[model samples]
Target: MPKISPKLAICIVYVAAMMMDGLDATIVGPALLAIGGALGVSPAATNMVEVSFLVSFALVIPAAGWLADRFGTRRVFLGALAVFTLASGLCGAATTAGGLVAARVLQGLAGGMLAPVGMAMLFRSFPPEERLGVSRFLMLPTTLAPALGPILGGFLTDHLSWRWVFWINLPLGLATVLFGLLALPEHVEEDAGRFDLRGFALATPGLGLLMFALGEGAARGWGDPLVLGAGLLGACLLALLIPAELRSPAPMLDLRLLADAPFRSAALVAVLASGGLLGMLYVFPLMYQDALGATALDAGLTVFPESLGLMLATAAIGWSFPRLGARRVMALGLLGAAAAFVLMSRVAPGTSPWAVRALLLAVGFFLGHAVLAVQTVVFDTIADEAMGRASSLLSVLRQIGGAAGVAASAAVLAASGGAGLGAYQAALLASVAFLGGALLFALQIRPAPAPQLRAEAEPSV
Candidate 1:
């Protein structure tokens, strides 16, 4: 029997964590109505459940690097999973919306560490030469979670209860934690600097408030004082955070990494590209259920095939990047994603199931390819010592981008008039616009010198 390589084993643990995180993020969309009914809250009120989680999640992410360095990656990771598991239990047991929201806050705090720390561990384990293969391991959870979330949520809600959605995380979280304890090797940094309290003070609320403002704007009018005020305040704080971190000797996050051209371009591209993908994820489920009159399970299944395409596209990147070059490969992906969005915009209520599936599948494939391409660039340029900081920044950017996407789509859908083919079309057009922006950024990526590619291109495991 072939032995499991340690790199693969560590990746498996990260996949498990990512899958759990992804499921929780998307599952709430499907289970929202049921949760509202159970807690005797209005639909608008229940949105706070997701908002609470996102806010807390964004707030704690900046601290992930500090915690991982000060403690140990393994210890921080396992502790996070434990806290997340316990919070999931609390979320499941809650009888009120307020209780559930509070529990979600705790879950988010724990979750903030999972992706960044886990990713740092992966980078630390795999040498730069082998890092291209890392995308495949990531694809499993990254593709599966959003793919499985709605289907699982719908089934559990239809057959069991919405509470089971939160309950479901308990077993997976616990098992992954247990496995991590045995499998993960400790790699504590010797001189992890002092935690930057002032930077933390600025960043945490700054990000949280920004995320909160986006979430609020999705539900409340953008002009509402609270939304406007939160947006202004958050922006001001983040504006302040930059200089504070750059000047600080012990910054909570390593803002200096942005100085690297490759990392900066890749990060910006990720933020732009993710907006389109997240918009589609939010819009498609609603379009199927509301526009096409499909049932929850049916709508979910309609979207499931996209994951297959995503996995295929991610797998192809390992082979393609060496020959095509990252710039060209990513350019093709962005163009293809833009085309998919255009096709999706033309979809109507009466569009055939097969046609819709084909469009979404194309979307998933293009986006998967595009995202992985940028991610490869990010790791390629980021230094070994700053891996943890880079990972956390990437994760934070992704969450912020997703929230922005959902908000933009929601706003367009509302403004264009709700729950109809026109609204869906308008929302999809917004996605196309976002992808077009990403394509421009993709075009800006200069070709890496030949030596760089040859040095990084090791055989996939």
Candidate 2:
């Protein structure tokens, strides 16, 4: 048998790790009630299981680049994967709410580091011109994992046990970690610089608090003192962080990367598009379950076709990217996504589920084009040394965008007075507006040059 290429091995490791990470993040939602009952706590209290993970995840992300630069990408990625797998086991074994929450925090810390560092490694493995290939690999984990999460969780909870949700990661995570240790290449920047204590001091609490506020504000209402206080303080700290990091000789985030036009345009478009897409995802399930009175499993199934559309679009991107260029592809993609949302906004109580499924599939297909375009072009000009920092910054922005999107959807639902079909429609239209805003930014992106293929020596594992 031919020895596996180092790049292929890395891709396999990265995809498996990311799929597990994404799956873990979303899979617990359907099990929350079961977990609460098993642990002798109210379902509301079990929310901390997710909150702990998200908060710790947000807190750790700003430091991921520094860790990767200081400790080499391969070491950091493998270490994080190991810790995540262990935490998954702990989560599965927990008998108390506190134990589960503690384990989740550990899981979040590991996951926060895992994703961006892994992304930096993957991008470094491939040249800029060949990133469309990377994007194709990317679509599987990013699209399928989240789409399948709720369905899998519901099934496992009903047929086996909620513990299986966390336990399921064990084999996948362990296999990926072992493969990664054997195959992943080491990369460390010599001038990684001293730890940015000041930036970390500011960013950790700032992002953590902001994430908490955004998450809780939707459930507890924006006027709640805790939410208001956290939001205000978090905003203030982040405001201060900008100037401090900008002046530091070695910034943690390397905000200066945004100065590149392609990077800036693509990042902005990505954040806006992420907000719309995630918002739609969050709202649609609620709409199906509440407004249409569908079962949880049925609701998840209805949305599953979107993942199929995403997969199909990702497969077609190589053909489209060469012909349309990044600018036209992204612009037309966003426009098409917005049209899908417009149709969704017309959905009512009596609307056919098939129609909703078709609209969602359309949304995923068009949005996939825009998303892959961003991924392909965002780092086209970033140097190899700065890849870690650039990936960290983009990750931070996408996190904020996703949280803010969910919060905005919740706010619109509240304003419309309830979770009725009309309220859900209004919230979806808000997503369309976000897509419209993204289209404007997509238009500003300069067309990427045609890719030139070149053969380079592959490093042996």
Candidate 3:
């Protein structure tokens, strides 16, 4: 057997952990009805399973960086992976809705740590310019897993049991944990400082409540008192959190990173672009199944082309980034993605599935270009010592963006009366508007210097 380099081993471990995380996040969707049925819960009550995960996931994200820095990346990541696997077992074995929700909370807490810490490890393993080479590792975990989730979930629910959805994570998660233990290197930042209790106290509940409000508002009406109360309270806390974090000697989120132009631009572009893409994912299935009367399987299959396009585009990015520079690539990508959304906005109930598939392919291809560029450039200037906090902050922002996207899309659909081709079309156009905003930011990105690009292109000694 060929010896695995440390970098290759790190990539494998990160990809495995993230793939499981992504799969777990979306896999529960298709099994919700079955899960609710088995647990003897009302459909409305069943939503708690997902909401619990989202809130807990939001709550733990701000703490991930500190834990990784204070302890060690390998330890935190492997521990999280092990806990996530154990939680998956608990979820599968649950006899009641409350039990299931509790297990999911554990799952979310652990799941939240996997991404940022693993991301930090992955990026730290490669130089800034050479980071593009790891794009393939990213594609499976980020794009393919989410795209495959509904399909896999639906299949498991139909053929076997809803419990299988969570159970499936067991082998995958356990294998990852074992491999990670053997292969992953440990790193701790000496300057990580004491825990940012003040920042954590303020940011944690604030983000949790905000995520709760966003998730509930999309499901329940925005006018619901719970939604209103949570949203207002969350917003107020977060408002106070900003200044508090800035003044703190060791902030949990490190908002000061935004002062760096490349990081700021990349972060903003990530939020907008991911919001649009995720919003489209949320809306497209509903449009297909409800408005167009397609089956769940058909909807999932139609959406699969997007992942295919993303994989192809990501494979090409390793070649493209050194030649075009990040700025031009991002701009062109945003432009193309916006155009694809514009085309998709015109999709009607009468439209052919193949036509929709082709458009989604374009959307995914363009988004691959934009997202990979953002990822490659985000940490270019960030010191290794700060990579943990930077990754945490970016993860939090992207999560918020994703929730906002789903909420905004839901709001648009609700405004248009929720059950027509026109409503879905309007919702999609909302995503296009987001892509346009991302384009504006993408244009602002300053490309790396020519010398750096040349260095990135040359073969390593």
What's the TM-score of each model vs. the native? 0.82, 0.78, 0.79
- Candidate ranking under TM-score, highest first, comes to 1, 3, 2
Clashing pairs in 1: none
lDDT string, candidate 1, 118-230, tens digits: 87898899888777777654665565676688788778877888888899999988898888877778889998878889888887778767766766665576798998998
For candidate 2, the TM-score is 0.78
Please write out the lDDT profile of model 2 over residues 50-165, one tens digit for every residue. Answer: 66676677668878877898989999999999999999999999998879978998999999988778878878889998887777656655656866987887678768988999
Cα shift from native, residue 325, model 3 (Å) = 4.1
After superposing candidate 3, which stretches have Cα over 4 Å from the reference? 1-16, 25-59, 68-75, 89-105, 116-147, 161-163, 174-192, 318-325, 380-388, 446-461
Model 1 compared with the native: what TM-score? 0.82
Those runs of model 1 whose alpha carbons end farther than 4 Å from true positions after fitting are 1-18, 32-55, 72-75, 93-100, 118-147, 175-190, 379-388, 449-461
189-252 per-residue lDDT for model 3 (tens digits): 8877688788878877787777667666655778999999998999999999999999988787
lDDT of each: 0.76, 0.77, 0.77
The number of the candidate with the highest TM-score is 1
